[model samples]
Target chain A: MELLGRETRERFGLRSRSQAGILIFSLVSTMMLLSSLYAAEASVFKKAREAAIETASPILKFFAGPIGWIEDRLGAISDYFRVLEQNEALREENAALRQWEEEARSLRGVIAALEELEAYTPPPAAKPINAFVIGEANDAYVHSMIVNAGANEGVSRGFAAVDERGMVGRIVDVSPNAARILLLNDVQSRIPVFVEGSFVEGLLVGRSTSQPTIAITKLANGDKIQPGQRVITSGAGGVLPRGLTVGAVAAVDKKEATVELAADYARSRMVRIINYKFPDVEATPLGAPGAAAAAAEISAAETAPATAADAANLPAAPPAAPAPVDEGD
Target chain B: MSTRADVLMRLAGAATPALLGFLGVILLASPLRLFGGEVPTPVFPLIIVYFWSLYSPGHLPAASVFAMGLTHDLLSGGPIGLWPTVYLVTQQIAISQQAYFLGRDLGVVSIGFAVAALVVSLIVWFVMSLMTATVLPLGGIFWQMLATVACFPLFALAFGRLHRRVVIEV
Candidate 1:
């Protein structure tokens, strides 16, 4: 009788423990789901996440170097085996590109003539800062990368990053020595884009896959968007510059089109940060403020003849261009 | 003096999961691009979490598992709390089957890990779809699951050697 009572009590205890574990699991999962839902809107979580990324960046970069080198060596060995085929493919592509280049040159001449006729002042040149990729978000659900460039190197949030091929992403977070770029395929990424031939404006949303979701959100009624149409940034929201090549349409449905990104992010070792800022007419002068002012002063003086006193008054030719930033390669 | 040394050894042993898990996170985030295609990188930390939970559950508490997942989320640029939830659930399952796995049969453990990987991968896919408001393509997730299961045996062998050689009762 005593043994039976003891066994029954133990079984009851075990069942209760299991029940408790299940309850705790459910509670924690609920909280996590709720938090994830609000993560995009939650500033506190964003700051905390950025701080954590900053803390982990250095250690990650240190360990990634040897592994990357090994991978690169293996890739090279594999490439050697396919050299003939690859060479043939490249030759064919080069021939096609040459033909396109001639057409592009003619189009450029026409566009230039039109711009001159309209007295249009082109936007300032985009400053390029090259940075090495240090880390990547390896999960399937979120595509992003960490680069060595940061605020200290003038890489700010929303600045577009591109490789030799084309668009990579935009800087989403930056510390002093590192920044995170939200790749074009990340679920959170959204960019304004337009079809090349038709000029149909669309919203390109990342699907966390190779192809992005391109919805023709704004377009003229009855305008048909065809597959194989080129896509470029529309610069509607002012986050990215206008006319930056994004990708080409791979497929189209009634609701959305799919874009195959031009940049081969998996193979890119280095990317350039495009330091582009939309021209703020009220805030900015016609040209560089100091240089323009100095040029005007020189021209005004030259109208009569410069005296030594006038020369002293002329602002020093824009202080010798600050030595180029030392990007830790 | 002897007791102090024993405590130090235990403390070092206690830190094993955290350190190894952090290394997995680093490897997961490394920009090596080892594979040529668009397949997702193998989840290295998941292996660590599973191994430690089975062999040293008391040492690597659930809290540590949660923390590692949280760290992965912050670094991997996903929605915060997603990985933590995944890790916690996986850890719970591993812990429940801890006794069944104590025999250290590599086949059983590998099979168990494969199931865990499938469950975790499915959950991740579901949660991501919910977040993105569209049924995401499962091809990448499927490949990631396969890669993770494929890598489990190697990680288990390495970790087993470490456990027997370095972390044993000396």
Candidate 2:
């Protein structure tokens, strides 16, 4: 009878201990959820703050006038003593750059005019907004920052951020008046890129540390991809544009390679939004290059295709005339 | 009336954390910057945490420690929870260690402070790497901890006066 009583008591104690374990687990999860929720709530706080700032714009502007003066005075004095010579050098360098730019622009015009003359058009356009850097973080683990511009400024989530140098990162979260930029050195960041020399495609992953690591999954076991090669967005994925210079292969770390970014994250003070819309090539006539030839053949031979079908479903164009079939041949 | 001194004493107790917290952040930011080779070590926040936990737990509640950690997170640009977790854990550890450190000499106190700082820093780095799934360099973190440890004596001496004034000798 005593043994039976003691057994019941022991069982009761065991149940109580399990209950405590469950309670602790529930508490930890609740706290984690609360932390994430707090981050989401921060966006609302920023929106409210932005509204308050806007309402007091005039008063703030008055105060900013003196701050602006100090900035200008400091800039002027610094320029007078240290920057004048540098500015002169920059102007001379700028002159050369402008000449080169003009030459490149004209060459581009020649190619584009010819393509247009042949009735070439491009993918749809996207809306873009210029944004200034309010702050930058170049930490060892996470390189990111908050920009003053936000959803109120027409910035959207997942938009690719970049400067003249190259890609910056994508918009992770945004408030009405402020947005956070996840830099290329962030661990959660990744982008698809195509190797210029080999046309081999893979992903560029960030490590949060200064030297972000690149992990290419498509290459063969003994593939020989060289260093110093250029990498650009493949645009095979619908997110990023094709031919945007992402970076160059910096080093081939045994199994993978690292890319040295073109944009100096440390030096960049501003960035531009690449305005591009994913083109549904299948909807466009360019889906099959020879579609035109086959298209012309069918149109010339008959008023309509024999089968009534979607115009976009037309068969591929006939192969371009054989090399020997040229006019002189 | 039991008015003037009572209100003054209460006010001083309430404001200690905020005052100390602000000064601490300013001191801490420089040291973190120096670790990155851009600025110096910040000793104030760690010092404040130590002082409050050891002498004035009522004024520097754990919630306030967490908030201060969050603020430091914003200023230092670290992962938001990193410093707050460190602050929370350090506050707890500091409280628990007060008994061991109760009558220790200056040298022992300094060593104790250094160990506590190292533990807090390690906690920050460990949890950070776990969440981010990336390795952070520990070399700079160590140097920063050493600097904070070295400054403990000076901070304790300064805070000791205020502590004595606020809490009557028991």
Candidate 3:
């Protein structure tokens, strides 16, 4: 290796020390790039990446502190300039919302009655963990952001992240106290979604733009996707929960449909990471041991006109019961 | 001055460019939305690397550039080594063309950076597309390159001042 290096340096007439440094570093960098591509899926590489982010999280948060303060001050100044107009808009919105609230109340009652008649069981409630956006990767090719919540805060990979308006993205990497969210507009992000009120199912694929297009996976005969139709998670892959509002279809062409994301990526400061666990099939099965006992207990509790506080005090049912068959049998 | 003090000053001078490069990475990764809309992030580390390579390649060095790019990749959650390779190759190019950029006015230097930024953006777009096995959009890359080129003069001015005041002074 030393002889080859000397011969190459002599042949190229590269006598400068800096030239040697460049050559050596370029070779090293090429090797590193190739190795990284080869080991992209290796666990060690993932761990190292997580560790680097974990170490840098504190430094990033420290740098973001002043930026946050500046943003707040700027927001306040902007708000002051538009307060009157905003107040009038808010008042109009409030009046309309009151009527919608009443309608929603009646709809809730109807849904409850329908659910009782159908013996329907709702999906498990999601636990939300709040996080602050500390960093963002608005680079040429990648669109992602770092949040100040991670495994320690009940955040896990694949957990859905949402702002007030709608879905933001999902957790892709998580350290102890930090996580990276692959935003909806990143080139690598893909989510299964279906247009609301239609049988048009498709994959929401990002193209490094604000509007991600839909790649149709399933479309029933004679069903057309139109503009302004809401797009939502299909839960087909079991990674994300079903029925989360993703976005609304903004434009539809013969071969492509784009969605206008609901979450305001540019101005979103806080997000809620939803920690949801898909329920196990066996855990909710009928005819298991203790099933009749649990049903009787539930019936007894239902027979009583319990107050809300009493409902809170009720004992929770076991998730699953063991089989009662003897070993000999 | 004491020998120890002189040594510390020399070390500080040597470390200044790399430190600024790291700072560039941190600032780029930080969510400092000074603008209200989706503004493209100017490639700060690229500017830093190019400036230092043109002026004093010994101070910033190729290794430090590699580290900065790796840190950026880690923070951005992109493919590791993707940026390090880009940065190292860019640095080499900058060093090779140092003679032309040296003693040039800000406008000329910035024009040079414009060309470099265009090339780097295309390289990144091509490599990323190849890695992902799909043709990535070019709009973001174009905006980013434009922003980087537009911001180059300001960064070059700052780094030039820092170079004169501290790097050469020490």
Could you tell me how far off, in angstroms, the CA of residue A217 lies in candidate 3 after the best superposition? 0.4
lDDT (tens digit, per residue) of candidate 2 on A213-315 = 5677677555666788888877766877777788888888766788888776644556776556675557647576468657876685584444334344555
Best by DockQ: 3
Best by TM-score: 3
Off by over 4 Å in 3: A1-16, A35-39, A75-99, A112-118, A284-329
User: How badly does each model clash, as a count of residue pairs?
Assistant: 0, 12, 0
Task: Give the per-residue lDDT of model 3 (tens digit) for A59-175.
Answer: 989988898888788878888989999999999989999999999999999889989875556678888999999999988778888999988988999999999889999998899
**Model 3: clashing residue pairs?**
none
Candidate 1: tens digits of C-alpha lDDT, residues B1-170 = 99999888877766877888878888888885765644568888889888877776655666677778778888877887788778777777787787578886899999999999889889889988888888988877788879888889999999888877656653
lDDT of 2 by residue, B48-103 (tens): 87777766566676656766765555544444456666666666666667767877
Stretches of candidate 2 off by over 4 Å are A1-106, A123-127, A135-140, A220-223, A280-329, B1-13, B19-47, B70-82, B99-113, B132-170
lDDT of all predictions: 0.81, 0.63, 0.84
Best lDDT goes to which candidate? 3
Sort by TM-score, best first: 3, 1, 2
**What is the model-wide C-alpha lDDT for candidate 3?**
0.84
| Residue A276 lDDT (model 1) | 89
Q: Which 10-residue window of candidate 1 chain B scores lowest in summed lDDT?
A: B32-41
